[model samples]
Each structure stands twice: as structure tokens, then as C-alpha cells.
Target: MTSQSSLATEDTPPGGPENPGGGSGLQAGLKNRHLSMIAIGGVIGAGLFVGSGSGIAAAGPAILISYALVGAMVVLVMRMLGEMAAARPTSGSFSAYADQALGRWAGFSIGWLYWFFWVVVLAVEATAGAKILNGWIPGVPQWGWALIVMIVLTAVNLAAVGSYGEFEFWFAGIKVVAIGAFVIVGLLAVFGVLPGSDNPGNGFGHLTDSGGFFPEGPGAILTGVLMVVFSFMGSEIVTLAAGESEDPQKAVTRATNSVIWRIGIFYLGSIFVVLTLLPWNDASILKDGSYVAALNSIGIPHAGQVMDVIVLTAVLSCLNSGLYTASRMAFSLGQRGDAPKAFAKTTSRGVPRTAILGSVVFGFLAVWFNYQWPDTVFDFLLNSSGAVALFVWLVICFTQLKMRGIILREQPEKLVVKMWLFPYLTWATIAMISFVLVYMLTDDAGREQVLLSLLVAVLVVGVSFVRERVQRVR
Candidate 1:
């Protein structure tokens, strides 16, 4: 295994030698401003906008705790990723580190699983954006909207990496502005300072008013954790993108350092506004969704429509990043010889056309399944990919453990962004992730998701070993 890993590491240097100018064939198209927005906007997903309602319904006001817990975990995971990425930035990100630290199977399995997760995300976001667009214009069918979204984003990705960054910069900027405005308005209403506000200075009373913070019991916090954890999936996208930036090291360092404020303001802060503006058990929360309901409480006219526009932007942003992320992972896999060689080939402009098309093709198929079999096949795809965020975080913990020692031995100065407490916190994160997976088994819906995701993960790991054996024989 050691020999195999060493050989694999040598064969696939960081980013590969495909382009003489940089680490990889990818160009330095992402500017510092683009990186800043990507880091800020990546945390504020459509899930926080739409899906948090169910989490609030499940855990009541304690949902804030759920968001905080998940937020902290993401911070630690990103720090580990930043340490490696800053030391040696690459589009492959943690997968490349896994190859060097653990073995070939580790890198191959996680890379493909991460790729699978994003492609599925593409379909989900496409459908979501389609629903909103179709509601606005009923003449175009939902499928038509989905097709249009998929094609437009695919073109943006294929054109150049900068197009993706530029589009994301605007998309993420809108989301940040929307949430920041919401938090500000919510605070005003909560303090009875906003003129013409219906919700007059309830303060934290709503936190305990309905059934108390833990209406469902303290156990509900864990349930909320399970519910809200996936919303944080896109937070690490900055690390993957750092490879294509002009100063990969600085971009990663800045992103890693700012993760705390981003999550605090966006997830925790926005959710705090919602809880304070209205009771957790308010019918409007579950009925209209959290953000929209909060806006309605403050006498914001057309709150639903306003939120629809924001959520649609978020969905399109996710779809855009999803396609870019999945394609880049494919390109990285190809660079390492884990995938088709053509995937590593880039256009003159440094766009991985083949990899982008391959990922989008799968995404289009997933969209078709979503339309044709919303409950059966499509549901399975969702469940099978549901636990991937946890899986990726766990791998980063383990990879960082091994990688920390390697870096210290070879070149300690590269450790610009270290994991907080070394092996101790890393182990703690692994334990937390393991506990969540085990906790997931107790709930019917979570159980199905965990089992299905595990089935797919096991199958992928098996394939990696088999491929390794075949290579050894040859």
C-alpha cells in the first residue's frame, strides 16, 4: 500500500504537468473579489432559505444550536483543507491530499463521491429553480425551465472559469445583500425601532414563549442537527476554487480565516432574526417558510414574491457552482489517472470542456429522473448522496491527521493555516461525524439516507480496490 501510494503521488503531481504556466491547465481566472464573494455566498444556500422551515418545525428555537454546531464543524474541516491547499493548492483539493496521505483508494473514492454529490445537486437545484420560474410564467413547462437553466449554466462553465467566477460573484453578492438586509430589518423590528413594523420588540421572548426553546425536548437539537447539517455542503467550494486563482495561497488563507464571520452572520444571524421576529411555533414559519414568514411579520409587503426571487437566485447559484465543482473534480480525477484521460484535456482558454460536458450530462439525466420518477429513482438518488457531506468531512479529518505530520517533516513553513488543536480536534471531528451517522440511523428518513449513501460508498470503495488490484497485476 505504501509503495502504491508513493507511486500514485509521483504520477500525479499537484495539479499535474499539463500546463507549463501553473500547477494545472486551469487558468488564474478567479480574482480576489470573486474569491471573497464565493466564500461568502457559498454558505448561504437555498436550503437555508427553504429547508430551514422543517428544521425549525422539528427543533423549534433550538434550531439555532443546530446551525451553530454544523457551522463549527464546517470551520474545522475547512481549516484542515486550507492547510493543505495553502501548502500546495490544486483543483483536486483534498482528494489529492488523500492520495498522498492515505492511498490511491482513498483519493479515488472520495473524489468520485464528491463528484457524484454535486452532479446530483445540479439536478436538485435545477428542478427547484424551474419550479419558481414556471410559477411565474406558466406557459413554459417546469421541464423547459430546467432545461434552460442547465444549458445556460453549462455554457457559462464551458466558456471559461472566469465566467463561472463572475456569475457567482454577482449571484453570491445578491444573496449576501438579501440576507444582510433581512438581518438588519429583523433586528429593527425585534427592537420595536422599525417604523410601521407589525412585530413590535418581542426580543428573545419568542425563544421561550411557544413551548420553550426545546419544545420537542433536548433530543430535538440532534434532530435539528440532522435536518440542518446538509445546508452547509457548499461551504468548502472556495478551497476547490482557490487552485485557479492568481494567489491560491492567499485566497485560501483569507477564506479560511473569514469562515467564522460568514457562517455567524448568514446562518446563525439570519435564523436568529427569524426566531426573534416570530414565535418558533408560529403557523407562518412552517406554512410560509422561515425567511418569508419573518418578512411578513415585519409588515414587508409581497414578502413571498420577494423571497421567491432571492431563493431563485440561490438555486441558480447552486446549480452554477454545482456544475463547476463537479467538472473540476472530474478534471482532477482525470489528472490522477482515476478517470478518462480526455477529462484532463483543457481548451486553449483553460476550460475543461470534456469534463464539464460529462458532468452536465449526468446532471441532465438526474433531472430527467427527477421529472419521471420523483418518488422512486429520484428519491433514491437524493438519499444516496445525502450523507456525502458528512463523508467528505470525515475524510478531511483523517487526511489532515496524516498530512500534518508529512508537512511538518518536509516543510513546516507551508503550514499557514493549521487545524485548531492538531490530532485532538481532528479526532473530535471524526467522532462527531461518526456520532451523527449513527444518530441518523435512529430516524426513519435519516436511516434510509444513511443506508443508501453507505451502499453507494461501499460500492465505490470496492471498485477502487478492484481497480488497484488490476493495475498491480498489469
Candidate 2:
């Protein structure tokens, strides 16, 4: 076992110093371009494509506010995470930081919770991707498509880290380009610069013209927050993926620095274009996707089909990253003695075969449950993991608060990417997360998601505490 001092050293990976067990057998196989694209595209997922529609329906143009709110929260959390990650550059990422700053139980609990979250995400992304594939080829069943996708991506992850990075690079490239094009074209149309954008609604009027900004009420902004918050879940994939990059510290710092623009342009910018180009009340935005509906409004032919392809890419990217992340987290747990040591074992290729297979096994079962009892099993899985992003963000905030003081006192030179405003903004971000959680409980639509997530969190915590007590007795 490695000491905490060894784990805290720079220029090494997750396990400890540059020793036999260091990095837990993971390799720094990802290239610069792969790191760049993962940094840019990591946050852009199928959620923005499919789920934003519902958020728009719930909060109308005010949904933009929802995106901004969650985007700010994510930016703050990522900044905090970036500070620690740049310093230590752990594959465990937040869990490792939590262990250093909080306790072993914090690391164990959050690590397992994060693993659970992503394993379920694998099933969700696989199912979502399968639907798009099945639509294109009706001969293949949805379950078959889901299985194929999971298997292919699983192979990519197991083959090597570079393969996963290459695949995600392209997947995220398509998404980034698609959204960037949408923003440019939609902005042109909004300003009546596009040739066929002579329609009366082709301006900023739709934002307020459609029952005002808060169509439902001011409460709907919070509702929109709840609806859109989950869309921002995948942003942390960059930090996790950075662990396998050639320069983990540089990768984390670069990714952290660029997060603000990514969220602004890809999320808020694109959504702004959609609201301006089409009325928020339009059925197609929800019936179809917000982006597709906006494209269709501007006479873009086969817009829905085009978007379906991009959404598929996003889904596949999510599944690929999910497997990589969960396996890495499991491997970290093993390294820290929080998980079975077998998971710390890896193939010659530096792939955590045991960890990856364990995560995939649960993913396949979730996909099976999704097919067998779509409503009950899948819904429960979805809700149980729904609020984990928020939970993770909360932990990041607190961990940064404690870790910041330590960094400043013990390792002042390690402060590469510091959080703005020190503890002030950090406290504000925490309060904001608390408000969202409390808001979730009050809102009937989000209450179940919050409750189920809390149950899973409590269960993990309980298990962590039990394990700690047993170890002490032993």
C-alpha cells in the first residue's frame, strides 16, 4: 500500500509514486488532440439534444436562465476540482481529493456513488443510442442495438485508453460542430440575415412574445433548474479522462480554463438561438428536439434525421466515457483498499479488465431491466442516480473549501488553477446547490428523483461506515 505522502506527489498517477503499483496499471495513452476534444466535447451530451426539450417546455425561454444557473454552478465546481486535480492529477479525481481533504469514508462513499451513477448512465445512453439506431434500421430491435453499442464501446475501452479517446474525440467533434453550426445559423436567422428567415418570429421577440419569459411562473425557473441541471452531468468526464492523458496537470488546467466558453457557446448560446428562432410554445421543439425544431423552422431539410445522428454520437460518447470513468473509479477504490484488490489488477494494455467488466456487467443488466420493465426498473434506476450530479457538485464545493486552506498553508506552489473569490464564491455555490436540492424536494416533479438519490446516497454511506467499523475492529 502507498502512503498518503506518496499519493500526494506530482508527476505520477493514481496509485502512488512512480512505483510498481503506481497508477494502478493505467497508461497515459491519450494524445493532445484527444485531450483537447474531450475537454471541449466532454460536457456536450445527449441530454442537451433530447432533454433540453422538456426543460424548454417547463420553463419556456426562462429555461435559458436554468441553463445559465446550472452552468455557473458547474463552472464553479469544475474550477474547484481543477485546482486539486491539477495539483495531484489523480485518476480517482474528486474521490481522491475527497479522501485527502475529508476522509476515507468520503472517498469510498462518493467513489461508489459516482460509479453507480455512471454504470446506470451506460444503460441510459445505450438505450437512447439504440432508439436512434433502430429508427434508422427497423430490422434491428432496440435491445439488439443497445447490446451492440454497449459491446462495441466496452471493447473500445478495454482495448486501450487511446481507442476510447479517439472514438470520443470524433463523437464529441460532431456534437461540437453541430452545435456551433446551429448557433451560427440560428443567430443569422434571428437577425434576418439568413435568406429564408423573413418570418416574423425570426428575432428575439419569441423570448417574451410567448406568454412572457416565465410562462408558468417564477417558480418555473427553479423547475427549469431541476429539469436542466442533469444535462450538465457529464462535464466532469474531462477531469477523469485527464488521468489517462500524457500530461494530467496540463490537461486538467486547460480543460478547466476552457469550461466557461464551452458552456456559454454550446449551451446558453445555442439555446438562446433556439428561443429566438422559434416560439418556446412550439410543439416541435418538444416533439422533436429543440435544435432540430429550430433547424426545421429555418427550412433545413431532414433536420430531425440530422440531429438524430448527432444525438447518437452524443449517446455513444456518454456510454464510452461512462465505462471508462466507472472502471477508473473502481480501480481507484481498489488501490485505496476501499474495493476488492482484484479490481486494481490490469491487463498488459493498462486496462482495468476486472473493473471494466464489473461495471459492464451491471450496465448490461440495467439494459436488460430497461427492456423487461421499462417503467419500473429503468425509471427507478434513472431517479436513483438522477441527483448524483448535484451530490457530486456539493461534495466538490465542500472539498475545495477544506482543501483550499490546506493547499494555501502546506503546498502554496501547487496552486495552479485556483477558484475565484476563495471561500466567498465557494460558499455561495454551496448555498446555490442547497437551494436546488431544497427546491427539488418542494417540486412534485423532482421530489421523487431527489428522494431516490438520497436513499442511494444513504445506503452507500451506511455501507462505507460499516466497512470502516469492521476494519477498525479487525
Candidate 3:
């Protein structure tokens, strides 16, 4: 199950009657630009825009360190994932690699868990996006707006991979542009360059001037990590999306190569501007959000309103990509015989119609549960999937460690995007994630997320084991 053997026939024809849903496979409609943008835009999410306010408030300016730590961890994980993805380029991404490198149990558990995570994200993002729309158009009820957002994005994904890519391209473009402008303008204002403002820019004093970077105490940095790490959840979309690109290996390579600079510029760079423009303790940051507060500090009119529009775009982008990621994972699982055969079915346009519809149906139901019991069912769904990103990364690191050996021995040629320090950094990443998980248990807010996620993980693994045993008996 080395990548070389798994992807030996990239152009092979579809499965025959014996494999019901594996008829015509997914189309490679994603272009070079699509991959590049997905790589760039996937890192910029609504979390960075909205959630950072709370991070800044918690860890003060030192939240930058929290982001840097998590960012580095993610970069390593993606490198490892990119290595496997470049070698195989399956729509299942790490899950497929896990199947080959680990066992069917690992693949089945992770694929289904990842699918569950994103489908839940579909409901969350849909509702978040709907709130913005409902704000603009008061006539539409919140649920109606949620339904509209889900239906529209579902249509885009069901059309074709290219449609998803193109829509994500623009959605991500808006986020990139908005953040880029925010960083630029905030920098200019930091140096007292903005017109009509005599304020001798706050400079770097904000990092220490208030109560110092660790005003909230050193422990808060880990708390900040808990708050911000989830923002990095969708960064793996590049690896997932690359499977549909015209040249997947090239896409994976380029995406992997650019992750460092992307995280540096987008996450650290933007947060740097925000902290410099205003103190981390600035009440406005907590009230108006870090980005909007930065905008307001420079006297930008309607900064909050402007940020709402950008946040809406980010929400829509997340929903669109979430649906795409979940459906593709389901499709891949079906192809691997880990899911229902119907999930692997594709339309004439090469869209996984059944997979997309099935994921959306669950998303719609989740949205209903959210409206009906925001405190009960929705909260459980949210907490249960909250830590799956960390779990997925853990699986990727272990898979790559094993897969790396196989790739090196069997097919050294597929090592275009190798993980740095090989087994060393891979092991370090696992340790770091484990430390984070352990650290999460010490806090009330993070404790439930980790516990619930572990519960879900255990349940999925149990099901995989049962499935394997049942198949063996037959």
C-alpha cells in the first residue's frame, strides 16, 4: 500500500459492475491557479478574523507566541501530509494513506471522524453565514437564511469540483484581500502616517506597555492556544483539494512549499499589526474584534460594519469548503469499501452527487438540531468534533512516520515533498499535540472539547473494528 503502488494507475478507468459506486471517478477540473489560491486562502478563516479578539484578550500580546507555536506545528503536520498526498493524491488524503500505512481501522476511523467534523462545520458555518445575511435582510428568518446558504453552496459543490474550486477561489480571495489591506493600513497607522491623525502611533509598546505580554500570566498562552488552534482547522483543505487538480503532485508540492510564508505573513504578520496598532488589552478589541479594532484605531469609518462583510465572506468560504471536504472524504471512503457503495456515485459532471447530498442532509439536520436545542444537541456536536483537527494531525504524523519508511524503501522517487527532520520532527509534532491535549484537560472550557472528541474518536474506532471483524467473518 505504498503510494507508488496505490497511485500507479492515475488514469485507470473506473470500476466495473462488481464495484457499484466506483463507476466514473472524480474529475480533475481544478486548475493551477485554483490550487495556489486554495493554498493561500485556506489559512485565512473566520476564526482568525473573529476569534483572535478573545485570544488577544486572554494572552495579551503574547498570543502571538501561541499562534506561532501552533502555526509551526501545523506547518510540520502539513508537510508530512503533503508528503503522503504528493505520493498518492487520493481524495481521502491522509485517511487513505493511513489505510495503507497503518491499518483499515485507522483509515476508517479517521476518514469517518474527519467527515463528521466537516459536516458539523457545514451546519456551524451555514448558521454563522446566515446570521450575517439575516442581519442585512431582516425579512429572512435565521433558519431560512441558513437553509438558503446550505442550498446554494450544496449546488456549487454538486455541480463539479471546478465549481467548488472557483467559488472557493473568490471566497478566499476576498478574505486574503481584506486581511492584506488590514495589515497594510494598520502598519501605516502604526508609524503615524495616516492623514489627519497626529497620534504618534502606539508602536511596539503595546506588547509590554500595558501589563506586559503575559499580563494574564504564562498559563494563558496555552489557553490562547486552545482558542486559536481551531482557526487553523481548514489549512489542510489544500491537500484535500489537490486531489482534484490537473497535476496533484505539483499542487501538493507547491502548497507544501508555500505554507511557511503563508502562515508567517497571514497569521503572525496580521496579528503583529493588530497588537502594534492597539494594546492587546484595549477594550475595543474584545468588543469590536481585533481586525475591526485595528481599523477603528486608524479612524476608518464603519470599520465594524466593513469587518462584518468580510466575516460573512469567510463564513461562506468555510461552509463551501466544509461541504466539499466532507463529501470527498465520504466518496473516498465509499470507494475503499468503508462506507456505503452509494456514497461513491458521481454525476455525469464527476460530482459525487450522493456523497454531497448525504453530507448536506446531515448538515441540514444538524442545523435543525441547533435551532431546536442550541444548548443541548448543538453543543454536544460542537464539542464532540472540536478536537478532531488535533486527532487528525496525530494520525497524519504517525502515518507519515510509517509511510516515510515505506516510500524511502519502495519508491524513493515520490519524496518530492519530504517532511523535515523525517522521523524526528514527526515525533516532536506528536509530542506537541499530545501535550496540548493534556494541557487542554486542565481547563474547564477546553476540558469538555478534548473529552468529547476522545469519546467520538473511541466510538468511531470501535465501529471500524466491528466492521473489520464482520467483513472477516463473511
Worst 10 residues of 1 by lDDT: 5-14
- Off by more than 4 A, model 1: 1-16, 19-24
lDDT of 3 by residue, 49-100 (tens): 9899999988998899999999999999999989888876777888888888
User: Candidate 1: what lDDT?
Assistant: 0.90
Assess candidate 1 and give its TM-score to the true structure: 0.96
lDDT of each: 0.90, 0.86, 0.86
Residue 98, model 3: Cα distance from true site in angstroms = 0.4
Q: Whole-model lDDT, candidate 2?
A: 0.86
lDDT of 2 by residue, 303-340 (tens): 88898888888888889889999998998787777888
**TM-score sort, best first:** 1, 3, 2
Query: Which residue pairs show collisions in model 2?
Result: none
TM-score of 2: 0.95
Off by over 4 Å in 3: 1-19, 197-199
Clashing pairs in 1: none
